[model samples]
Target: MGNRGGILPAVGALALLAACSAPAPAPVAQTTTPASASAKPPTTGPSSDAPALGPGPGSQPPTTPQPPPPNSPAEVTSACPFLGVTESSATMGVVLDAYAVEEAKTTQQDATTYHCTYASRTGGRQLLDLFVTVVPGTGQIPSLVTAWTKDCKGPAKPIGGVAGTTRTCSLDGADSGDVMVLVVKKSHGQTRLAELYVRPFTDEVYAKLAQLLTDRL
Candidate 1:
């Protein structure tokens, strides 16, 4: 009976040891509530468990820039004043059809006539050299010619009558045979061909200019 009693206790000890040695079941995940369980869905970007941020002052949308329009005449005019035609009205007794860019003073040593000219709109040709000066003390036309001739060569042959109590002479060695210098005293002002030189020289152009000075100036 003693042996049997000992065997029974040993069996009980083995079963307890087996129960302790068995692999522990995986621990179940707890169903407890997390601190962020009742939190709202993110309205902005994701972040750590920080508090929801309120909108800051004046968070308006960004503005987009617009491009300027092409083919604006006002912009072009503002940029290039010379690109447009500059015309003289018929009222300015002495009028030019084109813009007259002021030239540097001629190299002539003794010059009294204040000279300016408008280039032709037609062919980029020089239309006329407009001269203005005080009426001479002497009634001599040659003196005025002498004053005009200081810059230019002396003169060709003196030609009589094309217009207005005036005598003309071609500047000697002038490249253009169409070149001539006339001296005239008109009603409004003294309109003279101080020097009229044209390319592809011809006497016809010269004659035409002489007549124009007569009819117009």
Candidate 2:
């Protein structure tokens, strides 16, 4: 349902509009966001109780800090190249033959972004898309994702490995239908935005990937 990094999204990018209705709706054509997509600084919350942190360093980022000039293809997202299942290590039972990986050249202007999509060879269904947006700050992402939990279906609970929280969203018939998971955690001086678009994943597997990614960062 989301773009796979750069300007263009690979196959099945649009087939993900609506998720989990009794009978899935006809897949609607959707356009991916351009590479220049910018993230809006999260809106101010109830007298914001969080403090921003200084940018130091975390796990080595995937790509070079300075990206190529605009309009060029972005580098492969750095942190989790281990994503995209194969014949040996499949994700959730789907043996994805291949995956589409791309990086956001200018995500949110100041943040770095990476996206990966794993799916069948013949196309149609995009089993999963792992999106990571690394913005420089501390507590902002955790605060933002936590704030979002208030309207979500599940309770926001803490998980080990990463310093963050996880929550599943409730449907308001306003989403793309994918049962997604939102995990926000902190590393040295950056906040991680790890968003997964998958067919309902258990908290265990979700935490595994979250830890793996956080460790990579």
Each model's backbone clash number = 1, 4
lDDT of the candidates, in the order given? 0.27, 0.39
Q: Please estimate how well model 1 matches the true structure, expressed as its whole-model Cα lDDT.
A: 0.27
lDDT of 1 by residue, 1-217 (tens): 0000110011111000000111112222322332111121111111123232222243222221121232222211111111111212222233434443332222111112223333343333333333322231234344444433332344544444464544344333445322343434433332222233222234444554444444333
Tens digits of per-residue lDDT for model 2, 86-127: 421333554544334342232433554455434333434444
Q: After superposition, how far is residue 153 of candidate 2 from its true place, in Å?
A: 5.1
